[model samples]
Target chain A: MATPVYSGAARTPQRGRPRDASRDDALRQAALEVMAEVGYRALTMDAVAARARAGKATIYRRWESKLDLVIDTCTQLAQQNLTEPDTGSLAGDLREFLSAFAAFLSGPIGKAAQALVGELPHEPELASAFRETFLTAQRGVLRRILERAEERGELRQDAPRGMAVEIAGAALIYRLMLTGDPLDLPFVDRVVDQVLVPLVAKGQ
Target chain B: MATPVYSGAARTPQRGRPRDASRDDALRQAALEVMAEVGYRALTMDAVAARARAGKATIYRRWESKLDLVIDTCTQLAQQNLTEPDTGSLAGDLREFLSAFAAFLSGPIGKAAQALVGELPHEPELASAFRETFLTAQRGVLRRILERAEERGELRQDAPRGMAVEIAGAALIYRLMLTGDPLDLPFVDRVVDQVLVPLVAKGQ
Candidate 1:
């Protein structure tokens, strides 16, 4: 399993009583649910507080703005959901990782992630935070998987390792964000066997 | 050149003084420019009219709402930009097609497309129009390219042809939306040689 790398390292110093971990998690989860349902434009701190059964002041105390809360929520979600699979072969590892990824995209965080992509070009701060935390962590999972395959000599030395990682999960994302297609296991397997396997695994 | 497939076939019947072709084109171009600058959420019919130097009534006479206007704008953009390349080989076809595609994504319509992606899930009308018009037309171009390769005996009989089209342009979309990276020829070439070639071209 991939370890959670984000530890709130960039968070501003808290001024009040120490933050409650459980409450923070609940608020973040609620924020994601709201975002998944209504999208970022309609999301507000009041809605998040209402969904979390917490006070608006409580949310303000922890995060400066709704965008901050969302960034924190997505970062936490990435840390929790990302896992490294050692399935011994490149194809096996890709299958495992992509299946898990497909399932993640089918959930609330996945929908919320789509909600964020449209705004990234406009919101530089959120864009940087997303790339730095969630995207970096997700890429690291695939990078390690590819590196292990290279070590086993199951991949060509000149294999497009970086591009493979980028392309691997892209089908599911393209489906989710663009086509609005359901992400299924069969589709995941096809991408693994037909796309990732051919592109990265040694000796086509 | 890929023929302009969309000819406003889906546009609602206009019920005013005969619409001006040059004026409508100006309105759509203005809509794209405003969207690229302010994003979908901030776009307004009045703003589009102002940018196009047309009256608000002129804008509404052509389209029912701002969303309707955007949908029309994107459809026109797709028709104007998509070109089918005949380079006698899949690699050459993809290279030409992708370079044109990369250039398209670097412009105003490209920015508007990203702005719309965030709202696709929330707006079923826009989603269906996007899928039916812009997305379908794009897939058709790639599908033709792959089918040509198959006919020439360059691709395996069962070479994941549909998946090839899906995966081929995914890296560019991934970078433009997720990573906030610059899309350049070198990156485009890397995707072609490193990923697309190995995935689709027979015998690696």
Candidate 2:
């Protein structure tokens, strides 16, 4: 039930001592490592500071609380991993973007993220950051692919857009988190071909 | 990553006394309550025993570890809630089953379960129990409905059986855990109607 402090917006930059980008990067990486090791509930600002080799006051100056630090760090990490891959076709574009996403989830940030994702509902700010910085970004990539497909006459005008955006990612996550299934290239291909292509692609 | 100790097996009954059914029930309920309060990684046997008003030794004698106790408690709770409802059509059967599941997730056991689900990958035994006791059981119900539909010629013979079974639940979980979206009756209806019905229903 802890209120999560989000990283973006509403912060007037302090006048004295401009922020150090490298030190901030170090702290974000440290926060991820600490969260991966200890999980969300046990994560403390002191632990992140110690891990990052920065003074506690330094961390506090940037982030109002531990949740803020975590949200900021994770948001940065997700943004860093996400790139919209355009392959000219919706199927190819989806596979590229989602495959990139699946790879990220299999990496350090994603591993750390799993520990915190379960707790998103308790903290409104955290959930918002997760959606805005991560989930929405991923969905936005999918949405763009669909729109382009429509322009090229590759997608039907009435393909259930909401359901189209959701099913592939939903099924992939279920396989990853719930079933512990292998998320390889071939698996991604199947999701696109079988589920996604069937759902939306024109003249398939 | 700690290997989770599962509850159903590998317990050699301690020589002194057979476990009383009522005492066992009390312990499981107490374990659930404690987990609902503290979450999975922080849950301890001492807390469960204290909550149950039983000696720590009694709990230890039966279950090997806290993970074992939690798995047992959650599995029992899931089983208690899982009853195959036959509503003649796949859509009705899915709606009824998933609705019941959504209700359980909104309750005490489900609330506590959200905290533990994230840790499943770290613990092999815990993941197995989850897949076996809860997830597989739920899937099994869906499979039966699908099979029955096929038998009645209500389903296409070439419908991707695996994807058909997976999409609805996956979308629901995506909404519940990832999107933090409301899993209300209407949302469930869309998942069933928009996604699921299109996936398998004949003549779509």
Top TM-score model? 1
**Model 1, which residues run further than 4 Å from truth?**
A1-18, B1-9, B12-19
Instruction: Give the interface RMSD values of the models in order.
Output: 1.5, 1.7
In candidate 2, which residue pairs clash? Answer: none
**lDDT tens per residue, model 2, B29-139:** 998888777777678899998898889998998787886787677766666675677778888878887787777776666667766676665557778867876677667
lDDT against true structure, model 2: 0.75
Highest lDDT: which candidate?
1
For all the predictions, what are the DockQ values? Answer: 0.70, 0.53
Poorest lDDT segment (10 consecutive residues) of candidate 1 chain B: B1-10
B77, model 2: CA deviation in Å? 1.5
Candidate No. with top DockQ: 1
Fnat values, one per model, are: 0.74, 0.56
Per-residue lDDT for B93-167 in model 1, tens only? 888888778878876567777778766776788788878877777788888888898888788656777787787
